[model samples]
Target: MQPSDSQLTGVPQTVIIDPNTGLPQNVVIIQQPSSGPKIIGILIIIFGAITVLSEVISLGNTISFGGLFLVLSAVNVIVGVGYIAGGYMIQA
Candidate 1:
């Protein structure tokens, strides 16, 4: 009979070893996810949502600026969409 390979390490499996026996253990360790990115992503997503929702008010205010107002207001929407995408990308 021959020694088998570890699921994760394949050959010469030295990943999770039993300290007392000094032999590889069939155990897998999973670490908790960091909350930093989640927190930041949520905040950024919220800010993006706010910015997107507030466009109506912003556009109203910019109406007096005449022709350039649409372009300027569109910029705000684009930025808000970018923030939303950035937040999702950060999470990934």
Candidate 2:
């Protein structure tokens, strides 16, 4: 029988031989997660909630300034979310 084209490489079909040791070696790579962004996001969310609550308490009788509180709460929430997202994105 004629040797197949792949066999022409002179390497074994089921094994790889390392050039330095003439032995087979297995290597594994692992990746770690970043935790910064997630933590920041969580903190922002919590802080935003607190700020909104406080604004509500301070406006108990006045309904006219509701918009102000709404805006402030929205900004705080957004910032918190951004921090969390950033921390996670920067992790190695």
Q: Against the true structure, what is each candidate's TM-score?
A: 0.60, 0.39
Clashes of each: 0, 5
lDDT of 2 by residue, 1-92 (tens): 88887766566678787786766885455868666666666665566566656555755543555777667756755665665455455442
lDDT of 1 by residue, 4-89 (tens): 67545456835877887777865666999898998898889889989989987777678877688788789989999999999988
Which regions in candidate 1 have their CA more than 4 angstroms from the true location? 1-30
The model with the greatest lDDT is 1
Runs in model 2 deviating more than 4 A are 1-28, 64-92
What pairs collide in candidate 2? 36-87, 37-84, 37-87, 37-88, 41-84
